[model samples]
Structures are given as structure tokens and as C-alpha cells.
Target chain A: MKSTTTWINSINNRFWRTIVNSTATGVESVAVFRIIMGIYLLFVTTPTYTWIADLPKALYTPPIISFVNLLASDFPGRNFLVTVDFLMVASIVGIVLGIYSRFATLAFVILKVSVLSFQYSFGKIDHDIMLPATLACMAFSGWGQTLALVPDKRSKWDSPSKSLSVIAVLIGFGYFSAGIEKAIHWLNFDLNSNGTARWFYLGLYNLQRQPILAPALKNAPFWFFKIMDVVGVIFELTPIIAVLISRKAWRIWLFFAAAFHLVNYLLFNINFIGNGLVYIAFINYKPVYRYVANLTKSYIAKALILAAVGYAAVIRGISILTSQNVGIIFIPDNGNANLYCMLIIWALICAALFITIFKTGKQPVHDDLEVVSPQLT
Target chain B: MHSLKFTGILFAIFLIPFVLRLFGLEPYPAILFPSGPETVKQVNGKTEIETKQLFAKKQNGQWALVEPKAFMYPVSAIQLAKLVSKNMGFKKQKPFPLKGKIGIVNYLYRSQNSSSSAAEEAELRNWIKKRLKRGNYQTSEVKVATYSNIISTTNGNILKKELKDEKYYNLD
Candidate 1:
């Protein structure tokens, strides 16, 4: 009995230790993640709910959420949706600036969900839960503890925060779930059950999303698609285990995951770039933050960078409002050339992240005795 | 104690959904994909697949093939199919103005708007017109149809297309 008890205690100790060590992040790291996510949401993932508002109410098939039916009964007006869009933008700005960031995050989450719920009510439910889930987790995290006008008082800046670890676990389990679903449905020993080829055909014929590689890969061998199906299932299934095992394992898995998304985009024109951006939570950004700080020590350099970001944001906002087809860099279109450009850009980003992870090595664990970074303090 | 409590909460949050999904109840935010059995099926020694297409009739009295993407804006082809099969008469369900009850309650009642069909039809026509206007064609009618095709199971090449159902709406 005593031996069993001791074994249980050891396992519990190991689990908690792993969680704490994996999530041992500096305040600057979390702050950098906040800024990066805020910018990504503002420019790349800005909700175009105005078009959804114009959809006929007859098509409103509310999701499982009961409150959505009530909302659909008195469907929101176009002006109301536009106002929600603007408020979402304002809250994103607040998140970037770290001014009442928790509140800003909460507001953004509420507004985003409200609008997206209505959008999904038109019988199309997109699996876009990651961004909102991340934002919800961030609202209660130490992301605003550093580089903030209003840092969260409840957060212990010097200690390891559970937020990043939680996010990593969430993403891992999400992939695991997908992997399991595929395994159940796609793992039959039949040669004809090739999920990858099926999706490729669907995109090519039914969806009219002819990416650059679609034509080339159309006549590819059945065995090639079978291999892809196996690899994809394995890739999705291993993330949770990798995260729990070691930081290096997690980084390696993430690189492969990014590659997987890129491959999906290449063949199927299905974009999961938002999910890729959410992987930023798993990175230790303190070194990057420090490098940028050192590079922009001059006041003029800082001002210039800020101006550039602001100008880009303003231009993106204008493009969205005017419904202009902002080039494929910002919005992916049906152009083959633009598809190639996006692929190259995404590949470079994945490579850079992989290099950064290897170069930085393991993040240091924070304990009561460890000295906090001066800049963070 | 704090770590234990936090770990417990996290486990609960993740595990509940995991367990629920195992039982086939997809609670909100469940990770799902639209992959399943092979679409190509062998029926009576013949391999075939089902396909859907949207077509528009121009003012020039010619029916031109319309891309499903042109008319199904802000919704997927699959979603449009569901809306058509369920709400529209495509699947033989009473066309709109459906009367139903909420749960097992005695007093709670629900009724679809009578104008819903007309409104939805009008919107679909507008979408068709907008898409055709880009190509400098004036659309006067639209049709949503499904086809069953004998296909090459090896390469997914269609051998022949047999129209299954064709629903037409006059824009005039």
C-alpha cells in the first residue's frame, strides 16, 4: 500500500513539475505574444461580419447555442454589425497597447463571438474556436504584466504563468481530437479510403479552389495520397504527447504542424494560418523582445517602427472598409501567382521560427531564488 | 496546492469535452473535420459519385453553367445543400412556413415566416445576377441541381452525368 501511494505521489510531482517548467516564461515573453496576437487579429483576421448581416434571416439555422435562436429572432442590423466590428478593432488596439488588456480581451471575445455566432447561423459553422479560446485564456493571464500602461495587479510577473502551458495543452488536445476522428473514419484498410485525395478532388471540382499544385498533383499515385493520410494522422496525434514530454519535442512537432498547414494550403487552398499564428503562444519571445529593444534603443527608431505599424493598420482598415481586393499578402484570392507567394512567405516564417527555437535552447525555469530580468521588473 | 488546483481545473475543462466527444456528442468547440467514407461508391457493379451544380439562364435564352461559389456567398456549398434539402422543397419537406413545436412543451409553438421562401429565393437570384453581371450577362432565371455520375474510381474521372433533381426559379 505504501509503495503504491509513493508511486502515485511521484507521478503527480512529475506532472506538475513538467507543467510549471514548460510554461516558465518571462513577463516580456507574454507581453510580446500579446502584441503579436493583437497585430495578427487586427490586420489578418479582421472580421468581415457586414456581409453576414445582409444574409437573409430564413437561412438562419442557429448552432447548438440556445441564446443564438433568441438573437436570430431579432437579427442584428447592418449598422449594429458594423459597430461591433469597429468596437472589436478598438479593443484589439487596447490589447496591443496593454491598456486594461484583460477588459479589452474580454470585450473583444464577447464582440467577436456575438458577430461570429450570427455569421455561423447561416448554416456554415467554421472551426475557428482557437483564436477566441486563446484570447479568453489570455484575459486571465500575465500577458500584460510587462510593457503595459495598466499591468494586471493579480499576476505574479516573476513566476511561471500557467496560461502558455494551458494554451499548448489546448492546442495539443485539439489536434489529438482531430487525429482520433480521422483515425476512426480514415484508418480502414481499404485502398480507396484516401481522405487527402478526396479533399483535393473536392476542392478542385466542387469548390473551384484550384491552387498552384492542384493540377500537378491531380494524377499523382494513390500510394502517395495514402502516405499523406497516414502522416497527417500521426502528426495530429503526437502534439499532446510531445508537449508533455519535453520543450524540444513540442517545438519539433510545431514545425511539422506548420508544414502540414502549408501543404494543405498548397494542394487544397484551405488556409489555417490563424491557427499557425496561435502557435506563437508556445514560443519564448523574451530573446526576440530583447533583440528588438536593443536594436531600437534610439527614440527616433522606435517612433519610426510605431509609425510604420500604425500606417499599415490604417491602410488595412481602409482596404477592408472599401471592400478592395487587398493583394494576396493580406487576403488570399484565386490567383495562382499569389498562392505561390503565400506558400513561400509561410515557409520562410516556419523556417525562421524553427531556427529561433533551436538557437534559443530551453527556456529557464523560474523559482523563488532566480533573479528576474531587469527590463521585466 | 495552487498547482494541484489549477491542474485539476484544466483537466476538467479538457477532459469533459474529450469524453463527451467520445460518446459522439459534439459539444461546442469540438475539433471536427468533414472527412468520412469514400464518396465514390460501388453500386451494382458500377462505380459512381454524386455532384451538385448551379446553373443560370440568361436573358439571351441560353442556360449557362453557374459556379456554386457564385451564388453560395458567405456559406459553403455543403451548407447551401443542407438549407436547400431541409428548408426548400428539394428533399420534399414542406416548403418554408413550417410549423413546429419547441421541445415537449404543450403551449410553445414555432412557425417559419411565410415570406421566407420568397425572400431567400430573391436573395439567391440577386447573387446570381451579381455574378453574371461581372461577366456582362443578364440572368433571368437560376437552377440548383444535383447529378449522379458513373466515375473512374481510380482517377475520380466522371464517365457520365445523370441529372437527379433540378429546381428552377424564374427571376422575372
Candidate 2:
């Protein structure tokens, strides 16, 4: 009994230590997520920009139209969808700027809910379903102090950490709900063919729509997909246990989830919400500050040199390769080539910022408050 | 600490593909899977006709036969699923208004009709005809419900009988 008590005590200390030290990382993560989500929302809304407009008609079908036909008059339409898109863009902007965060969060919820309702009208779901719930949590939790519209409050009582904890709980709940859904829908409980597991495979392996994987998936020699499905369902169902196990474990999960989104983005051209935001909820803000400060002090110089080399190599490589391609050479001059050029230019600008920061080195800056939870007492 | 060789190998694995893609590695096939209009074909089948358009397939395997007409818009999976689920009565038929460059046409539709028209059916059909004309497809006779049960916006020419011969497009 004494040994067990001692072991519990050690685990408790380690958990708290990890939480406290990682505060800055949390703040940085929130900033990055807010900005990315903001820009992504903005980019998706601008329909005149056809690249993002590459979409299919089936997505606009409202899942609730039949129910609505029986129950309400609301059916998904282009104008209705456009309005939701506009609201989403505004909310993302609000989130990024930290302006009127609660209002932005609320607006985000309203717009996303309508969109979700439309989506739910069809029986399909994606990770974005959790965004509204996360926003609901953010409405209570104040991530804005670090990267938001409001000025930082003087007291610990109003610190973003309190709100962040709530956000953390919400994040956990989002995973938990999905996990529970798998549990409730027992067919999805298995690792191989179950719902969450299937998506992970389909989304990552680029088989979400194609019928080719159907045969291999159904009649595979090994139960590789089956194991994946089971593990995913278990992880999603009991994420609190999985999440609370260790920060490293949580980070690993986040990494896989992010990779899942990235694959969807690149392979299927599907955009998913919560790809970056989940990382924000998992952030422990204090360590981020320390890490940034340390980087400001030490590694800036190295990062610049690496960035320069990467840029030159990439540009030269592109020029050489595309020059020899017969098909690419004859194509009508689409704007993509120039667009990539702009991307490289911005990359160089980022590299320059890195150099500037490293050359100047770090100056002593005032420290942000460390979160000390009252619940711990 | 990790060894330098391992780190170098890791960086190389990450860097090489990106480099290759930048240099016209051409990740996807150059020849786009041709559009439906280009490849619309008539299937020699009974009961169901099939239209071979991109994203959607007609039952009889002919693009020209499904009435009122159908088309598709690329949408997020969430939206696609929601649309499919909301319009769940795949077997139930209801009169729906459809528009083309020609004009509005009323047609009875079942869920198996297609998702494009359900969302913006007319627009999608127009787009498919315009954009994806390369895929195999064919035109076929579409079943038309009598307009006698409804109001007419044109000259109030009351049809004396159910006009089965009224020209209608069908996609299998």
C-alpha cells in the first residue's frame, strides 16, 4: 500500500510538472492555430479564387431536407451556404485577431452549427464536427489573452489558463463523444472495418471514395486494417485515459490526427477542421515562451542558414525538372507556376525574419504568469 | 541523443520527394480522367440506364436518359453525406423543378435520381454537359409525368392526355 501511494505521488508530480512547464508552448500553439484557421477560413470563402473552389455537388446537399420537409422549411441552398461561409470567415478572423472572442466564438458556433446541420442532413461526418463544441468551450475559456482581441488581465483569476483547462476538457469531450459513438455503434467498435478506423484508412490512404480499396479492404490477407480500426475506436472512445496517460502520448495522437488531416488535404483535397486547433487545446503555454526565448537566444542563426540552403535547392531543382517535361511545357499557362513563386518569396521573407532574430539575439523580456490550478489544492 | 547519420537519413527522406515534385515529378496523371460528356455511353441493359459522368453514375448507364437531368458539384464529405442522408427516400418519387439552358422542366425524382439536382440539380447537369463532355455516355428516353395535375407558366394549354411522347431526357 505504501509503495502504491508513493508511485501515485510520483506520477502526480510528473503530470503537474509537464503541465506547468509547457504553458508557453500552449500559447504559441493557440496563436498558430488561430492564424491558420483564420487564413484557411478566409481562403475557402473567396469563391473567385477557383483553386479552393474545386468542390463536388454532393457536399451541398442538406442532410435534414427530408426531415425539414416534414418538420421545417430550411433546405440547404447556395445562398444559405454562402452566408454560412461568410460568417465562418468573419469568426476565424475574429479568433485570429483575438477581437470580441466570445462573440466570434458564438458566431462561429452558430454558422458551424447550421453548416453541420446541413452536413448531418447527409449522414456523413468529419473532424470539423468537433469545432463547434471546441468553440463552445473556447467561449468559456479565454485563449484571447495571448493571441486574441482582449488585453491581458492583471490577475491569475482571469488568466487564459483557466479557460484553457476548460478547452482541454472540451477537447477531451470531443474525442470522448466520438469514442462513445463508436462504442454505441458496436459495428464501429472493431479496429478493422469500424467507422473511425475506416476513415483513418480511407482518409490517409486516399481511398475515401474510390472503389478499388473496397476489395482489398474486405478481403485482405492480414487484418492490418482491422487492428488499426480497433485501436482507433479504443483510442477515440477512451481518449481521456489515453490523453491523460502522458503528454508525449497525447502529442503522438495529435501528430497522427494532424497527419490524417494533411493527407486528406493533399490527396483528397479535403479540408478538415480541428487539424491545427487540437494542437492548441493540448498546449501548455509556459514552456512555449521558454522554448521561444531559448531559440531567440541560441538557434536562430542555424535555422536561417538551413532555410537559405533549402530555398536555393528547391528553386534550382524546380527549374531543372520542369524544363524537361513534355506535357508540362505545352500546357496553357495556368497561374499555379507563379503562385508557387510567390510562396517561395514568402518563405525567403520568413527566413530573413529568422536571421534578424538570431543575429540580434534575445533580450530580457518580462515573464508571463505561470498557471497554478486551484483544483490542485 | 540521436546519431547524425540517422538525422541525415531522415532529412533526406523528407527532402527528396519534395524536390522531385517541384522538378515536374508529376504526382497525378497528366491525362485527367475525362469528363462525363466526353465518355457518356449507353449500356445494353434492361430496367436501369447508366450515365457515365464524373462523380455520379446513372442507373441505365446512359447520360442522356435520366429525367429530369442530374449533375454533381464537388463537396466536402460531410456535406455529401448530409445531402445523401437528408434526401433519404431513394425509392420515393416527388415532382421537382429543373432548369437548363433551355428552360425549367418539372420531373418526378427518386433519390436514386442523383445528388446534384437535389442540391443545385440544374446547375450541375449544365456543368456536367459543359465541363465533363469527354466521358462515355448516351441519351435515352426519359419518363415524363403528366403536367395535367399541375399549373403551367406558359400558355394555359391544358393537355388533353398524359403526354408520354413529350420529349424528356433520361440518364440510366
Best by DockQ: 1
| Model 2 misplaced regions, further than 4 Å | A1-33, A43-72, A76-84, A122-127, A146-159, A177-221, A246-249, A256-273, A285-377, B1-71, B77-172
Compute the lDDT of residue A15 as modeled in candidate 2: 45
lDDT per residue (tens digit) for residues A1-377 in model 2: 99996776666555433433322233344444454445444332222111112223432323212232233323455545555655565565566556676678789877666555444334343345455655664554445545443633433333333344434434455555444444454333322233332343333222234332333443332235445445555655453443455445555555555554443343333444343544445443343545533543455744653464344334323432332111122223333543333334334333432332233222212133223223222
Off by over 4 Å in 1: A1-13, A149-160, A295-297, A316-341, A360-363, A368-377, B1-48, B68-140, B149-157
**Cα lDDT tens digits for candidate 1, B7-69:** 677777767766765664334544443334343333433355555666666667677776555
For B28-139, candidate 2 gives per-residue lDDT tens digits of 1011110111111112210111111113234445433221111222233233223322331122333353532222122112222333445454443443343233333332
The Cα error of candidate 1 at residue A317, in Å, is: 4.5
Residues A66-115, candidate 1: write the lDDT tens digits.
35654345357877876776677778877876778888988998888787
Could you give the interface RMSD of each candidate, to one decimal?
5.4, 20.5
lDDT of 1: 0.62
Give the 10-residue window scoring lowest on summed lDDT in candidate 2 chain A.
A44-53
After superposition on all C-alphas, the RMSD of every candidate to the true structure, in Å, is 4.9, 18.3
